[model samples]
Target chain A: MELANIENLLEKYFEATTTVQEEQELQAYFSQDNVAPHLQEYQPMFQCFTNLKAETSTRNVPLQPRKNYLKWISVAAVFVLTTSLFINEWNKQRQAEEAFEYFKTTMALVSQSFNSGASHINYLTQFEETTNKIFKTENN
Target chain B: MKQADFLHTVLPFKDKLYRLAKRLLVSNEEAEDATQEVLMKLWSKKSKIEAYNNVEAFAMTMTKNYCLDKLKSKQAGNLKLVHSNYKDENTSLQKEVELRDSVSFVHEIMEELPEQQKIIIQLRDVEQYDFEEIAKVVDMNPTAIRVALSRARKYIRQELIKKHNYGVS
Candidate 1:
């Protein structure tokens, strides 16, 4: 192929306007053992493309059962976390009910003590008055 | 789709996916990770894979997205540079060294390109994607992709020539 024709094809190749056959021709032209000196810079690019194409096969990385395994793990974790949170909340509510009952009982006892103390104070005051009157009469 | 069927359909495009990832991430290990991630994503969404007009193009786009995500994460983490100099033992010494250096130079210069231009080069040169397919993959007009690719190639050539002269000096 004339240099002009090759150049034209190259332009088409870059433009992505070349037909498959023309692309194959360009690849073949570039892959030749001898490339025109002026096109040396493009040789590496062409060689890189061919090399990359050649390397494009399934690489055997020991399949670790898909990394989406982490997604499943995270889902399980969320389930566990939610269940634990619910259980904790339930326990907290139960404890609060018990504490409230205890507080109510303690308040009832405190009210009873206050009423008994008031009666005792009244009794002591009357006793003091009676003793004072008896002493006054004895002195007279 | 069954796992076997999904694997069968996508296995053929592994290299294409890898090349796209490699070009974007510029590291074999990262590219490998990105390829696996892309394949896993395709497998998970296999029901939608059939909807795609071109499976390879779809996979390439997925690979590019995965690589970009990986790159962003790496940047955020402030990780060591993801260099593209994975040397193959099968290549001859002289050619291998030259190609390695050239690839490194190209990769560095590629960083200076706009994201669209870099992606266009990756699609055209690395993944061997046609302009129309690339336009679909990138959602760009085909003519715009061509212009971006042309500019990217010119920039690479200029950078390479400058580097060559700099080394000689």
Candidate 2:
């Protein structure tokens, strides 16, 4: 704020002993329109620092987010789980259907053998009846 | 680290890295590339970055080293290291500098300084880094850094006063 103080700060600044706060005060003092004429020569340096500080890189920094991998992993996990579950269920249904087909074929074979045996039994019964009729006629 | 963590921690100071790279390399495009390279390096090592006590300081050191390497390998013929080579080195970068007035004049004067001195001034005066932090970035002790900074500040002052007097005359 005071000329004497700025001169003192400038002296400290050039000595590279000024604290950051003190350096900021000097910059603040110089940035105003009414710097002391004697110190006008020093103004550009501080202003240049300010201007350089304001200079930003217009280039883009590409930082692809890391979360995408996690998202894909979870999605992959869900897909595997559903696919396995579906396959498991389908496998069980197929096994049951195969077992039923085997049972039907086995039952049909057993019934076919039993039906042939029943037809032979029917012929034996008819022979027995014919024999009994002949015996009855002979006894009469 | 996570991208969000990196964005909060490292990405915030990218401009600081850019400014330091720009100051050292003296070309916006080179600085931008250097900054991107440094950032990509940091990201590659992001998992271990948390091990650092000061990530920003580490990033600054990386930028400084990267730009110096770039200058040595690619632009050794074109880049100036001292005032003697100032005229030859002052080509495309000089025309591209956007500062319009006395600030530009000071910038030119700064361009004449030794590379180390220019970096010290940029880190201390423009970036507001403390001496210890600057010591880490520049690989100099705090006392040596202070001395170099004082010399640079005084050099700028002498040049500015000379220019002012010449203008008045």
Candidate 3:
């Protein structure tokens, strides 16, 4: 009776009609120490399922857990980028201010030199007037 | 979902994903890589994971797709469907050898099966998945899944019995 039941279940198993419970029963029967000689060949097939199910990956699951870190890194990158840009603009502004200061100093130096030249022309005019007065005195 | 929560949820079934990859890719290293890749992909989609009714089924589908893609790529030259990892330390040497040979023969027979049937058998026979879960993973109706599974199971039985008889004779 047991053998008949197993044979029936085995047929349904191959036909893909066995329920999970019936399949488990078949697997249990085959896993025993003494399966009937005719059904012995089927032992390894069920055993293979058991063995394969036991096979777990020895390799570690490489989960980097870096998603939150990625968000933080992007934020830092933006912060760095904006700060560098602001610094560049500030540097350009300072450069322009320094250049204007140099220009103002240059203009002051040029004006001072022009004022000295004017004083020298005044001296020459005064000397010419003195010469004219001396000639008039001689004529008198 | 939070990453930690997602990890908690996925860690339990990580081995199942690995097994599916192993069944498809047939190499430990490749299977491991595929599992990791699939996990990362799921992590990327964790926000949208809530949209799915069953994350496990979704993950299984992703694993199946990823492994199939890997097999199709040129780098999978060594990824032949060979299951050589069977071992039995308690049995005598001769019996162990016989067991290993028969097991590997089963794998070779599986190799001859179409990729769909192979997956169906893997999910149904090995993983003990129900028709509905198998359908969700394969995107096939339950009836078609059952037919393909029946065909695959019968083919393996025929080939295995033939080999067993030849060995006995």
Best by lDDT: 2
Can you write out model 2's per-residue Cα lDDT over A38-114, one digit (the tens) per residue? 99888889999999999887887797643458879999999999999999999999999999999999999999999
For lDDT, candidate 1 versus 2, the one ahead is 2
Give per-residue CA lDDT, model 3, range A1-140, as digits (tens).
Answer: 28999999998898899988888888889888889999887887887777778888787766565557878999999999999999999999999999999999999999999999888899899998998887777556
| Pairs that collide, model 2 | none
In model 2, the runs with Cα more than 4 Å from the true position are: A65-140, B75-100
TM-score of each: 0.64, 0.68, 0.75
How large is the i-RMS for each model, in angstroms? 3.6, 1.5, 1.3
Compared with the true structure, what per-residue lDDT tens digits does model 1 show for residues B1-169? Answer: 7777777887777877787776677677777878887777777677898898888878877777777777788789999655666556588878766655665456567767776677777767765667778887788887777778878777777777787768622
Per-prediction TM-score, chain B alone: 0.77, 0.84, 0.82
Instruction: Name the runs in model 1 displaced over 4 angstroms.
Output: A10-23, A61-140, B82-115, B163-169
For model 1, which pairs clash?
A56-B15
How do the residues B8-40 of candidate 3 rate in per-residue lDDT, one tens digit apiece? 888888888998888888778778888898989
Off by over 4 Å in 3: A1-5, A33-38, A59-67, A115-140, B1-8, B40-51, B74-101
Ranking by TM-score: 3, 2, 1
lDDT per model vs. reference: 0.74, 0.87, 0.84
Clashes of each: 1, 0, 0
DockQ each? 0.20, 0.46, 0.46
